[model samples]
Target: MVASSSPANIDKSIPSNEYLLEMNIKKVKNILIANRDDRFESLKMIDDIQGLGIDLHFQHEIDQTLDMIYKECSQFYRYYGRDPHEAALCFRLLRQEGHSVQESFFGNILDKEGKFEDNLQNDVKGLVELYEASELGVEGEETLDSVRKFTFNRLIELCSGRESHQEREIMTSLMQPRHKTSRRLTSKRFITMIKIAGQEDEWLQSLLRVAEIDSIMLKSLIQEEMTRTFKWWTELGLEKELLKARNQPLKWYTWSMEILQDPTLSEQRLDLTKTISLIYVIDDIFDVYGELEELAIFTQVIERWDLERLEKLPRYMKVCFEALKMITTEISMKVCKSHGWDPTDSLRKSWASLFKAFLVEAKWFTSGYLPDTEEYMKNGVVSSGVHLVMLHVYFLLGKELTRDKVKLIESNPMLVYY
Candidate 1:
C-alpha cells in the first residue's frame, strides 16, 4: 500500500525518474525537431510516438509536422503516393489530425481488378500498417473494405507460419488495431515488444524510455486520483447504507479514467467517477433493492426532482436521491461558474429520462412483459447510462454551451446511440 511518487511533486525537487523523464522528453523533442523536414521520417516518428503512448507530450510537434506534411503532399500523395506503409501511415496520421485526406490514395495499391494487389501479401509491414489504417474508413468506402478483408485474411494466414515478434504484433493488431484501441493499452505492449526485439536505434530507445517513464508517472497520477475519489466515496457512507448497491468506487474511477485519459482532466475524471458511482447505486436500487411500488415512486420522485416527496420513499432510496441531487448541484454550480451557463435543467432532464428508462425495465420485470427488440433497444440505449455520462462530460469539458447544442444533446443525438 506504499504510495507512488506523483508527477505533481516534480517542482524544484524532482525524483531521479522524474528528472530522467524530463531529459528524455527533451531528447524526443530534439528528434522531432531534427526530423521536421523529412516528411516520411516525420510521419513514421509521429506514428511511433503515438504508438508508444507519448503523443500527449509532443502533440504540438506532431500537429505541426502533420500540417506541413498535409500541405506539401496532399495533392501529390493523392496521385503518386509513397509505398503502402508510407501511404497508409500518412493517411491514418493526417486524418487523425483532422485533415481531409482521401482513401482513394490507397487505390494505388490496387490491381487491374480494382482489388488490393496479391503481391501485398509478401509486404508484411505494409499489410500490417495498411490493416491498422483501414479501420479509419467510414461507411461505403469499398477500397478500404477490400483492404481490410485482404489484409485480415493474409495476416491470419501469415500468423500460423511464424512465431516471430513481428507475427505476434500482427496478431495483436488483428485483435485491436491502432485506430480502435486506446494508446494507453497498446503503448505498453509496443514498448515491451521493442525491448524484447532489442531495438538499438537512439530515437526508438529514447521514445521507449519516454513511454516507460510517462506510463509510471501517469499511473501515479491515476492512483492519486483514485485515492482522492475513493475518500469522497467512503465519506458519503453510501456503501454501508445501501448494502445491496455495488460498492465499487475504484471500478468507477477506472472507468472514468479510461474515458478521459488526459492528465490535465483530473477534475473531470473525479467528477465523472462520482456520477458513474451514483448511477450504479441508482441502478441497483431499481434492479435489486427496491420493490416495484417503491421503484415506481422513486422514478416519479426523480422525475419531479422533488425533495418533498422524499418522505414517502425508503431510507436507502432517499440516500441515493439526495446524493444524486448533491452531485448534480455541485456539477451545475461549477459549470455555471466556469461557462456562464446553468446546466441544471439539462442535467435534471437527462437524469429524469434515465430514471424513466430504468422504471420501464423495472415494470417490465415486475409484469413479466417482454418488449419487442426495437422497443427494448430504444429504451435500453437510455438505460445504458451512456447518454447521462456524456451529458455530464459535455458540461465538465466546458464545451461551448449553445442553446441549440443543449437542445440537441437533450434530445439524445445519434452520436449517443452508437
Candidate 2:
C-alpha cells in the first residue's frame, strides 16, 4: 500500500500488519526482559513505551513489570532514595498507579537548606522527569506545587539555546506536561522524533519497531470498534429523528477513545460512544428541533421513563426517547447479568438528571432568558452533561455502587469544570 502524504512515513517492516503486531509484542517483551533486573531502567523503559504510546498492546507485561518493581521497591529501597531521577520516576509511577508514595520521597535528595539541590538542576533528565512527574499533584500539595514551579522554570531556563536530545525532551516535557497531552498526539510526536534522531542502538531500533506496529494494530482495532457504533446508530434511526443534530459518529468515538483506549474497554467505549451520539441527537432536539411545549412533554416522559408516556411525546421525540430508553436498559441489563448487580434504577436516575438539565437549557434557549455568570455556571455544570456521562461510566466500570458516591456525583463537583 502507498503511504499518504502530509506527516506520513511508511513502515515496511514485518510485511503484514498481523506479523508486525506479533513481532512487536515479542520484541517489546525481549527489550524489557533484557533489562529486567535493573529496576530504574525497567521503569524508565516502561515509561518511555507508555509515553511513546504503545501501552495498550503491553498491558499484561506492563502490569507484571510494575508489580515486580513495586516489590523491588520494598527490597532495594536505597537506590531510589539515593538517586533523584529514579526517585522521581518511582514516586510518580507508583503514585499514578494509586500507590500512596508520599511527595516527601524527595527529602533524601533535598539539601539541608530544605530545597532541591541547585546542582540537581544541571541533571537534565532528572529535572525533566521531575517536571513531568510534578503534574500529578492533587490540591494542597504544597511541596509538589513548589517543585512544579521550580522544575518548570528551571527547564525553561535550561532550554535557552540548547539543542541536545535531552534538551528537546526537557522542552517537550515543559510544554505538553504528559498529563495534559493525549496519548495519540504524544505517540505521534515521539515516534517521529525517534525516527528523525537516527537511533543506532539495537534496543532503540526494537523499541521503534514495537511503537510502529502496536500503533497500527491499535488504529485498526479502534476503527473496527467504531464501525459497530456506526452500524448501531444507522439501525437505531437516530439520523431520521434528530435530523439537524450533529451526525459525527467518528468524532464521538475519537473523544471516547481519548479516555477509554484499552481494547478490553470495548464495551465501555461503545456504550459511552453510543451515549454521546444519543446526547448529540438529544441536544439538537432541545436546542433546534423541538418546540418549547413538545420539549417539556419529552423531558417529562424521560423523567417518568415510561414507555406509555413516550407515546404522548411528539412523533419526532418518540424515536429519540425510545432509543434512549433501549440503550439505557441494555447497559443496565448487561451490568445486572454480568456483575450480578441491578443498576437500572441508578442508570435511569442519571438519565433523568441529564434530561432535566437538557430541559433547563432548552427553556433558556427558547425563552431567551439569560442568567448571570454564577447562575449560568451552576446550570452549565449539569447541562454540560459530563456528570451524567461519568455517572453511567462509574456504573459501567463495575465498581461497587454506593449511595455516598452517587450523592457526590449528584453534587456535580469535578464535573463543574466542564
Candidate 3:
C-alpha cells in the first residue's frame, strides 16, 4: 500500500507567491529604468516569472512601469475614492509581472470603504480584460476569498451586535460536526505516523482538513460543556492528584484530545472555556519549560504557516498549536459575536510572552550555559504574568474568559520540571 503524503510534501508544492512578488519588486526597483533592451534580460532572470500562472503579453517592461502603475492607481482612487478593483488590478499586474509591491495596496482597496467606489470597479474590469487577453490564471483568488469572508463576517457582527449566550448555543449546535467513529489515536504517535505516511503519500491535505474541522467542533463543544465545570473543579482544588497527572506532557495531550472528542461534550461555551484553560497550561509548558530548539520550531511554524515547519516541531508542540488554533478560533468567533472585542488579542499576548521566553532561553541555549533556575523562573513569571494581566483586561471588558485560571495561579516550585 502506498503511504500517504505528509504536510511537508504538500507544502513543497505550495507557492510562496508573496515572497516571490517581494523579490521581483526589489529587482524592478533596481532595473526598471535600465535601458529597455536590458529590461528583457532582467525580467528573464526572475525565476518562475512566466510560470507564475498569470498572462503578461503586454510590453515586458513599461517605462517607469512601477511609478506609472502607482500614479494610475492614485488617479483612479482620486476619481472614485476607495475603489478596490482598480487597486487590485494594479497589484495583480505588478504581481503577475513579478514586482514586489505591498499587499496592503490591494488589501486597502478591498476594505469596506474601498469596495464601494465606482472607478475602482472600472479599473478592475479593465485589468481583468488585460489579464484575460494575456491569459493570466486567477492568481489571488484564495487570498481574496479569505479576505472577503473576514470582511463580511466583521460586517455581520457590526449589524448583529452582541449575541446572547443562548444565541451562541444555537449557533454552535448548527455548526457542530456529526460524530463519526472515534479513532483511539495518540496525538504524538499520530503525528509521527502522519509525518511518515505523508512522506510516502499525499496525506497532508486530508489531515489538514480533518484537523481543522475537528478543532472547530472540539473547541465549540469544550466551550459549551466543560468551561464552568472545569473552572469550578479547579477552584475547588478537587483534582489535585488528577491535576498532577494532567500536568504530565503525554497525559495532558491525551486528556485534552479526549475532552475535545467526547461525544457527550457538545456545547461550544463549555468547550471554549476548557480549551482556553488548557491553552494557558500548555502555553506555559512550551513557552517556559520546553527546550529552546523546541520553542524555536514552534515559533517558526506559527509565523511561516509552513507544514515542513510543523513537521519539524517537537511532537508535543505540534499538538499544542493544533489545539491552540481550535481554541483561539472559537474565542475569536465569540469575540466577534460580542462586537468590538478582538478575541485574538489574548492569543497574541500569549504568543508574545512565548516569544520573549524563547529569546531568553535561546541565549542560554546558544551559550551552552545553564540559565540560573531562579532567573529562568523569574523570566517565566514576568512574561506569563504580563500575558495574564492583558487577558484579564479583555475579560473585564466583557470578553468571555476562554482561558483557564491556572495561568493566574501562582507557580509552585515543585511543578518546575524543566
Flag the better candidate by lDDT, 1 or 3: 1
Instruction: For residues 175-237, write the lDDT of model 2, one tens digit per residue.
Output: 888877887888888777777764786666777887787777777788788789889878988
C-alpha lDDT (0 to 100) for residue 19 of candidate 1: 85
For model 3, give the RMSD to the true fold: 22.6
Candidate No. with top lDDT = 1
State candidate 1's TM-score.
Answer: 0.88
Model 2 clashing-pair count: 0
Cα-based lDDT for every prediction: 0.85, 0.77, 0.44
Once superposed on the true structure, which residue ranges of model 3 sit more than 4 Å away at CA?
Answer: 1-276, 279-291, 303-308, 362-378, 392-396, 399-418
Instruction: Tell me the deviation in Å of residue 85 in model 2.
Output: 2.9
- For all predicted structures, in order, the TM-scores are 0.88, 0.78, 0.29
Which residues of candidate 1, in runs, are more than 4 Å off? 1-19, 76-80, 196-200, 368-373
Model 1, C-alpha of 308: deviation from truth (Å): 2.4
List CA RMSD, all candidates: 4.2, 6.1, 22.6
